[model samples]
Target: MPMDWEAEFVFRAILIGVGATATMDIWAVVMKRAFGVPSLNYGFVGRWLGHMRHGQFAHESIAEAPPIAGEQIIGWSAHYVIGVIFAGLFLFVLGVDWARDPTLLPAVLFGIVTVSAPFFVMQPGMGLGFAAAKAPKSNIARLRSLIAHTSFGFGLFLATWSAAQVFQI
Candidate 1:
């Protein structure tokens, strides 16, 4: 009972997403412990999303937004879901053949490219302005984002490479 290509693709995507996201989380933890750098509070993300139910898409300050019940859970879940979505997008753009024999450059480049989401969309929507222009420490926030996204790219390559080995893809 060998798995079909589609099924395998789904499994691989899930693995890659979770693995890459976990790698980002590990990096966050390391940054926090080593340099006292703070991580983005997913609670704010949840609150942002939660507000969508009330026809609110953007916030003046996500932090000042009223808390939504179970916002943390929602935000965390959304975070991983977004990761998985990105993985799927990566595969779609690169194709299944790439998954079978993954490379680093494309994965890392893609990860770096993904930073656009936060800089343009999420940041503005959360009231930080473009690329966190309104952030208290905008430059630091931008740099951290670049680093984090770069790590995510590395994670993508690592996950894909590992999956290729384990699954014999």
Candidate 2:
């Protein structure tokens, strides 16, 4: 029974993560079509990870980095994996009960807080500087990130709410 419960928990977490990440991607598409905002190139994320294997953590510009084999696939896979991990973290922090009956504020806050990953670790490591301070338009970049993460939070809520309704949890 305990194992079954654990398995179910893990499944729920993965579902929530994937759903939230997909929501963010949808938002990116909408932004691109409606406002001409370009989405982040996940290929760069793969390149950064590939370089890290060679002890090269920072790059002047990820775009200029030598392309790694299958970088696009690697980056997209990692993106989804990271999303699942983030959802797992969210579940751990909020507990299974939240998954059973999710709310908006907490999920949204968690999503917004996730922006710190890019602002601090991912951006600096990719040579964008802290919080994209070095970007051509840092403010716009920051705002976009905020909106994306907020959307992820909303995704989390939507996923959980839908799950609760379907699973009757």
Candidate 3:
């Protein structure tokens, strides 16, 4: 039977998403253990999302906000779902050929672009201010965010390449 292109893209995109997210998570752990830098807790992510319900799109400090039940679950789920969405976007924008040949630059560029979410939307909404300007170590935070996103780009590349190899797609 001939394979369906739609099914292949969806399946591979999901695999790539999981791989990329895993890579990002691993990088976060390594940074924390090796450099004493901390990663954002998903609980804060949950809190931020939860409050988005009451028309509260922004906060002064998500950590200082009231906790919501299942915030942790919500945050973690959002993290993974966002990853899958990014993977889908990558595939949609670059097409399946990119996945088959797997270039690093495009993947990395996409990863950097994704950082805008945190720099603009997430950071400000979380009350860290734009680009984390309100944070004590704003520059450091910005750099870390860059590095993390860059790592995610690499993750996307590796994931897509691996998937292509495994599925021969």
RMSD of 3: 1.1
Alpha-carbon error at 136 in model 3, in Å? 1.2
Superior candidate under TM-score, 2 versus 3 = 2
Residue range 47-130, candidate 3, lDDT tens digits = 999999999989988989999899999998898889888999999999987888898999989999999989999999999999
User: For residues 95-161, what per-residue lDDT tens digits would candidate 2 score against the true structure?
Assistant: 8888988989999999999999999999998889999999999999999999999999999999988
TM-scores for all candidates? 0.96, 0.96, 0.95
Tens digit per residue, CA lDDT, model 1, 53-111: 99999999999989999999999999889888899899988987898899999999999
As a whole number from 0 to 100, the lDDT of residue 80 in candidate 3 is 83
Give all candidates' CA lDDT scores: 0.92, 0.91, 0.90
Candidate 1, clashing residue pairs? Answer: none
| Per-model tally of clashing residue pairs | 0, 0, 0
